[model samples]
Target: MQSTSNYLWLLSDILGQGATASVFKARRKQTGDHYAVKVFNHISYLRPYEVQMREFEMLRKLNHKNIVKLFGVEELGSTKQKVLVMEYCAGGSLLNVLEKSENAFGLSELEFLIVMECVVAGMNQLRENGVVHRDIKPGNIMRVVGEEGQSVYKLTDFGAARVLEDDEQFMSLYGTEEYLHPDMYERAVLHKPQTKKYGVTVDLWSIGVTFYQAASGRLPFIPFGGPRKNKEMMHKITTEKPKGMIAGVQHRENGPVEWSEELPVTCRLSEGLKLLLVPILANILEADQSRCWGFDQFFAEANDILHRTVIHIFSLQQAVIHKVYIHSYNTINVFMDAISQQTNIPAPGHELIYEGHSLELDLVQQVNVVPKTTEERPIILVSKDPMTPIGITYKEPDIPMFPPKFDLINDANLAKVVTSAVHQLLRITNSLMKCQDFILRGVYWMLAILKEECRKTTQQVTALNVKLNFCKDTWMIIQKINSLLPQMNLTEVGDVHVKLQSTEDFLMSISQNVQKSQKQLDLITAEWSKSNDIHHKDNIIGKVQVLLDKVSAIYHQLKKDRMRMKLQYNEEQIHKFEKIKMGIHAKKVLVLVRDDCVQKYHKLLTSVKDWMRTACDIRKLLGPIGEQVKNLNQNLENCEASLNKTLDHCSSKLHDEEQIVTKLTASTAHLDQKCFEMVIGMKQLKQEMEDISQELQKNNMIIQSGFQEA
Candidate 1:
């Protein structure tokens, strides 16, 4: 057992152990809060002092939600050895999660996304601070349950991390053999006699390996025995280029490289997501340093997947209510078209109903559909043709209508009319209240969705910018190559130039679409805040409609722009550009450039298509809800107007009664005064009579007294 100044660490509380340090789950004596205490062993001190202090300095300087936070350093009481007190992640490392039998093939789509989001965010934080985590693997990443019970991954173990710029080089070898870059592996593991320096892109390689591991159960590059026993083979596998862009795995020491572009069959990620994810893995896991994507491109592509809207449509016409995945954008029409292709249902002959409201084909999915949809609650498809049987009976909405009419002909009907009017008013008011609450909730939901969209768009824009930067760099290289080798017949340079120019144009167009999306999101955010001040039900509905309209317009335009770019990309002679015969040096550089451009362009196009598809589903889901809100608002307004008119008519009828009551009140007042005067006179007469009777009684009493005296 080791005791720090404020913590107690026992041998039984060991969380994990590495070569240099042992992490122990400890508790603070003062607050009793659990913390992870990392105690470095003497092996760690064997390194240079600066190297030993690197982790502490990095942890102290860095503060991000996705990065493990460092508390104050403490000295082990008995040995006076410095130990790091850090935030404890109860969910443990990502390796533990992957080690589970259920996750043998890979994490589920949701879990994978969570891992991607957290790891990317952590890496982004590291990048922002000009730090490179030389060793990024599943074991180094920790997971903690958030307040909402969602798994939040954090980057831990900065022992191998350092403050290095993107272009800076380091010769020190670090990282797990399986996750290390090919150059790093050649130098460190194989002990190759080369002075090759590693750059910041090394972290990307590790991330690629980690993410690939998370997506699929096994590592990308595996030899017959293992990475450790067959080190040279592993290096060869990592360095060699297969026939196609895919991961390589060898079954034997001298066996051929087995290239696979698809994930394992047991992977829990949907086929739709896999399609988007495979390309990302292919690009990131590229052994060729020149071909591997930068952190920016990786983040963008991953975020694009994260932001994708995958809608599960339930076919009510089917016997068992089968669910199908439809990736679409623009409107419900597109969604139906996709469904039509998948299910062979005529798009025009069927209606899509979600939560009882029939979705319009022309309505945008993102604005009107996605917010209200969930896996459990899918969009219900029903056949409109009477002969075709819908498996589940589609019931009409049971919305009640209220129309109050005032009848002021007689007094008997007055009370009835008032009561009916009041009841109708109450119902309308209650409905309006409910509608208002729904509107508020809808606005918040839309805000959340749009904010996510904005984040996705921002990532896309950043990626495009990165691609633009890459294009510029490649162009500069080309220009230099041309300048230096004036006599070299680089005929392929012209095609490369044209391709780069077109790629730039495509990237710019996508960037503009992203900007438009951001602007629309800003408008929605503004409207959401403004919605609080809008008291009128009709006005609120109108505001929401306008916001949806603007969103729909922008999305349609984006879809058009994407289509145009895709067309332009398709029309290009990519095959002609692929065949380049020139000087060996020039050939390699130009081929790399061409391949990079093609790969990035395809990825961008795929991302855009995925985004648009998601946007459409989201809009379609939201459209019916928006229409409901409008209908509810209209009903509320009609009821309110009718109630007001009835009350007005009743008020007019009561005006005559009010005048008649005034006349009667005046007449009663005069009668009351006269009756008071008559009562006074009667009272005075009675008093006089009483006085006479009293006098008579007194005289009688006096006579009685005289008689008594006689």
Candidate 2:
């Protein structure tokens, strides 16, 4: 987007909208660049005051070109709606591109690759900066159309982004649930004593999901109708195998997945490219964070694929117009058609001249018109009739894939030969994998059991603990294959099928064992009963301590095993293939060596083995946990006995006291009657003695003294 202004600014158009903000394309009042202004309305009260500011601060500090650039923040009148000025991306978004595609599926393999490269690069920078893009979808990825109409993708929208302080974890629920990591969703579902925390890894999961959507024009994890539809989406994201995520309509015999639906014909992806694509997808969609690929690993893996997957760009000099421009991935026919539009000449009557030869046939026959921009040569487009007068020159800007050229180089055969060699190498890899299918089947079955076990782990970890990372990666790879591989129809790239199986087996084995150990752990945890009842009795704390210790040991061992795998697995092996290029064939055709590409294929196989090994650690961490469970059970029994004894003794004492009180009451009543009778008798005896003394005192003076004494 371009802007030329010198007065008051004006809103030209609405760019987009979200729950909290609305973006618009605006003209600058001062002479400068065009920008998008994000306006936060009264509905901003739906969130917090600092929420938008946090995003602004994040963008302000981030200076990477892949990340959206922030210009300034402003407030409109009265309501004080905040407006954030930012770089205007003229190319729109990947989602818009997919929606506008003539084909149902989406962009071609080359276009997808370029966009992904930029997205990954941006993500890497964010991770390094300790930021997690909680929301990562096609809508959040913007495209910049350069002056020459070439495109570059950039990451945008920090509204859902989280800046980690000292890399601390986030416990609050944030971001779009559709793109939320499965673990994060599970956490939201199981908010009671939330055990899992959201980290930067969640961003990768969203990236993988976005990748799948871009490749297949549909989500791998479909959110269906229901009250718990969100949970269902989370479930699918977390559970589906990478290869099986985007299943095709008809299952080809021994196809990679059950839903092996064919891709749109426009995406003419080769089998060799698919071999690289599937594994990377699997790596990203891995459900287990421990087993998922890191940013560095993903970037390196992507680079490897790019090296093997070629997309040509070309330089063009229209001599009749004395003008120059570069264009790529366009065929000679398309180029001619464009020229015909520009000059009003019939495309059939025009020709693309490279080294004075017409390339009309090549342009018409190529699946997608790609140019030879990688080489240091240029081609010319001219009228087939020599008598046509030279036209006025209209110079165009240089393109990304094409450069300025005078002497056209026509060498399309090299690509064909290299592709053929790549085909043969794929067959060899496929054969190797087929030979070991039996072993892989064993591993596959085991992993399936493990996958089942993981699903059953609802007790120990709520949906929260299980985020969709590794699984998303797998889904992306399969989606790519399903969306693009159908058109290629090449049987040679069997290596992809092998690698996918390898990943599944490896993931399942490690997961199955860990889960089995976890299952044992969960059972133990359940038996211990963490009932929140106030009257409940048990040595829960002591037992939990043991459980924690036991689980930690097993978890640490698994972690150590992963580190070991990383140390041995090298993605930098691209250096070996970097320098092995063939010399130009007498400056006639660009020479390509089949041997070098073959070696690269062999290297990929080795890497696949390494990839498999990373997920192959199925070592049992169950022994200590089992022992702890036994101890907990025994401790529980002892607690039960002590509690029962104490309660029984207290009951007996209460009964004895009740009996003693009843007996004491009865004795007191009898004793009171007897004492009353004795007192009455004593008083009567005293009166009788006094009467006798009075009679005696009347008889004698001596008796008076006795009476007086009485």
Candidate 3:
């Protein structure tokens, strides 16, 4: 066993028994600081190694103020038994506080907020570090009472936590009773391990349960007794509604007295805060896990909540006003100078709406709003454009009057703009097709140049072979004449020697001329073979192979170019189709507006109210226009569908074209192989001619010696 002394602590006694481990109270010998060490047992469950590994991975990485700090870990020499050391809390668990304070002081709103904030802080930290506290309950939170009844809270327990991933594998058995997500129940019944497929929403659901009971002093959904069956618990979690108070309790029927009776609690709690917290909690508890906010969103919201809470705790009015201005941007710049005097606010950007004419406001560089003031400044609200498109008619080019109110978000107009932008993008894409064409032409030119060189090499090689053959014939003839002079017995024929010499001279000259011609022809042939067209020819074969390769490459490139052209053509067609669709949608909307206007014109003839008459006429005209607009939209959708179908067809054709191109490449390679063989044959013929010429020269020399002896 590993020595306990090495861990800088001494185990005083066993603290408690847990589901998967036992907790022991230990104190650091050096500092005398107490800690709770949880020992893990492997054999109690199957696949203990995997479980322990997971636990260690999660616990070792956690670092947060509200979260229980892990001091260290100890492992025995060979056993799977490992001990996790953590900071000890003296105020016991939140469960004890809840039980004691259920009726006494009734758990005030401020107190509940404080405790819940601790839990949220710990959770927020875990989420930022990419961890989840899947099990969040009153028992997991430990409270430490300071002097004069001040309590400090910390979050503990991570046996059920899960890390999120794009495709994480989770074991469904994680989480505890009354806190398990609805998905966990489904997973358990399905007998499947937890998958990292889920987001951080799972942890949020557990936190919601913790927060609900803490504030209301009762479980939001769970039954009051020991534990309910799976069916009962799941029903409550899924279908049960929020109740004002716990059941079967007469005195505490209206919720905790301190929390419920406080008409106005701390300024920290705002309507926005309540509104925000409820939805998050509800979403986390959703039976469908898909809708839950993942860790990314949770962390963002938690930070915002913390920031807001901190500002409130400090009684900083500027922070509260800054938060309000962020939500609503109208008339914010009017107070910019006043706000800047006390706070660190700077000039705002596109997201902010300036409702005043202040050149000075624009001059400032920063955007943070600060300080609180009551003096109102000169305000000028600039209205945004309406969703309804108004036709521009110029009688003498007059500026249009702004509307009384404008929607910052124009849903219909936004869609129209997007459709227009898409059409423009399609045009740009069509232009890029020309680039592909240029590349295709370049590739084609490369192949053409290679093929021409191959042809030239092949012709030169053929000419060389013919010249070699001619030299071979001439050398054979010279040898015949020389042989006759030696047989004529011209031993004393010093005069005969001269005649013999003349014949020898003629033969030597002929041989010399033939040798020169052969050398020239060989040089020409070798130079031709070295061309890029023939990359690898022994003599004739390499040149031939190069020619074939050039032809094949060109053919393949041509086919690819054709496919690319087709794709470009299809894209153009789709663009035209989409434009038509947009035109139709716009026309239909115009028609609707016009029909309504026309109807109003007819009603206005009898109405006493002049404004009503005008409005009625406008609406009447808009009706038929609307019908036309509807038709245009339908036609546009049809065109879009057709274009999409064409795109699919083009994709399928591309695949088929690729296969054909591959086949063409293979056939060209085969042709190259055949050409190589032919070149090899030419080389062998040249070698044979050289051997014959050498033999003939030796015969002529022997004949000259015989003539001198005679």
Candidate 4:
């Protein structure tokens, strides 16, 4: 036991090590209470007294659940070495957790959320106390397991932290290089002479980089070589942006930024989470300090996510998964409203099923939903409308196996036994043939339904494209007319024009998406035509599902764009502009165009709902067909083997061998005829699918012509 002046503690194990200090797990002799003792090394003692005391002062002043609580400073008994004792965190540092193989791709969403909440709370406390933690990284964050075995993260290691106001500038270089702000990075890593002082916003950059790494398991910016080997290249990539370069990401030093808004494939976050998180990252990771969001906005955005009730929803009819973010206190109706907005389906007509039981909307709340839900077991949404077909669930049926051997037989009863075995084999094959025929009919019907829905959806998309073009042209005209009006308020006009331009770009994007969807639909149809095996059909169904999800995403974006445009085109603004002759005409035309767009959008939503229903029905039908195909093939093989074995045995044992052999051969030939017929039916079904694809193309052309005429 190592005794201090007033306390006795045994240093059991080393917890961590750094350049200037080493922390050890220590226990008190009296109560056996555990604590972490951070002992300063020779290097730390050489620092200026004020610089060393800054950490102890900061730790003493801060008090929060998310910040590590500081115990007292103590001295070793005989050696008289000074040490700082603090609350012990059993779960270790967050860096240790992140380094685990299970978290190689990053922490799970729930765990990441916990980290975000704790870090934000701790940082908010720092802001309140007017302190800056210069070194804020994963290594400095410690995790403590709660009574319920949940992780609670707290900030520690304030060695580089100091008291600094929001506007105060610090000239001292600190923080890990990879997470440093560009200005700091230039001085710290590139060895460039930097005269500018860093403000509190530097922490925001570190937080951004840390959060991004926690989610993606890798740094955002990387040079062709590596972060350390190509420090100058990283500096250039961080500071310089060529045309068309994406912010905060550079795979190669001088190369253009990759053209993707998505996180890396290694990221474990869901699409819905990425949607909410990426915007925050964009605001915080800005190289320009003037543009970066302060802690206030960061807290607001992060808290909004933390406080929400997160649940994954799987639409059984659409065969798509969606993530819903809502207030925990909200009822199921509110949750359904969010789902409706995402899916473009009516809220009243949704029936949520969980764990094989229908959830009572009036009795359940969003808070209760999350605890019972998981990624593998999301709440299932079923359509309540009677007209909607209920999807058929499939289970593999038990297939009977042939007996390993025949019962004991003699030459006297050989003919009787052989005849019975041949008849049994024939019956089994006949049953399989009938089952195959039934599955084939179901496949054909579902395909026809899918084809009709695809045709309707394609036409609706075409009509939407035409309407969006008209709206764009009218907005352009409005911009021109508003510019020419001498009486127009230039600032107000400018804001509206910016909104209009944004809407125009969005509309253009929608047009491109529509064209892409059309091509995807055609490809799916072509694939369906060529599909003969169950696995091939499954792939085709998945493609259709992906296309539906894309359309739903477009629908939601359109709704948002329309609302913004409507708000910008306020009645008062229109009346004010209507005084001029040209302005009056263009303003009225714009109003007409907006109304037309709303109507078209609603129609598109209806088409999408119908399309999802049909596609789901096709998938449901395919499931059972796949099962039947496997069973039929297995039984056919068994029957053929049994028949051949019986014939060989009877020929060797029976006096009338030729007659018995001839009868068995006839039965085998008859079974083959049935299989041939089933194959022919499948070929015919393929031909019909090809015909449907042709008709879809022809209908698309007609639909375009009608839209142009309108």
Highest-scoring model, TM-score: 4
What does candidate 3's lDDT look like per residue over 1-710, in tens digits?
A: 12255343334466556678877676665676777777766543555566556666787788767877887787634564677878888777887776541211124445766686787777777766767676778888888775678777888877766676533545556666566665675465434455634455666767766766665445545332323533443444343333222122112322422212111221223333444455555555555566566656765665555454211111011111221222222243543433343233343311111221112334233333322322121111111111121111111111122122322123223323433322222222222222222222222232232233333333332332333333334333323322422332213322322433343344344334334434433443343334223222212223323333333333333334444544365554543343344344434333332353223322322221232222223223332433433343343334323333333343344345445545665678464554444344333333444454464345435433432332
In terms of lDDT, the poorest run of 10 residues in model 1 is 575-584
Candidate 4: residue 382 lDDT (0-100): 59
lDDT against the true structure, each candidate: 0.61, 0.48, 0.44, 0.60
All candidates: CA RMSD (Å): 37.0, 38.9, 37.6, 35.2
Which should have the higher TM-score, number 3 or number 4? 4
Sorted on TM-score, best first, the list reads 4, 1, 2, 3
Off by over 4 Å in 1: 243-246, 314-358, 363-367, 380-710
Find the 10 residues in a row with the least total lDDT in model 2. Answer: 582-591
Q: In model 3, where is the ten-residue run with the lowest total lDDT?
A: 310-319
Model 1 residue 452 lDDT? 60
What local lDDT score does residue 24 receive in model 1, on the 0 to 100 scale? 96
By descending lDDT, how would the candidates be arranged? 1, 4, 2, 3
- lDDT for model 3, on a 0 to 1 scale? 0.44
Write the number of the candidate with greater lDDT, choosing between 2 and 4. 4
Off by over 4 Å in 4: 1-3, 6-12, 77-79, 241-260, 328-337, 340-377, 382-710
Top-scoring candidate (lDDT): 1
Write one digit per residue (lDDT tens) for candidate 4, span 1-710.
Answer: 66665455545688998888888888766778888888887798788999888888889999999999989888776666778889899999988887653464568788999999999999999999999898888888999998899999999999989889988989898888888898999988878777988889899888887888789666776776777887887777777643222234556657655533456654667666776888888777777878788888988998988888778776654444567877788877777778887666698677666665556666365455545676566676655432332221112112122232322122112222222222222222222222222223223333454444345434544554444343333334333333332333324233433443454464455445434544544554454344224322333223323433333333333334444443344542432232222222323333332353223323333433464454454434332533433343343334323322332332233324334445565678464564454444434433543453354345446655754453
Question: Candidate 2 — which residues are off by over 4 angstroms?
Answer: 1-12, 46-50, 165-168, 187-194, 223-237, 240-268, 307-710
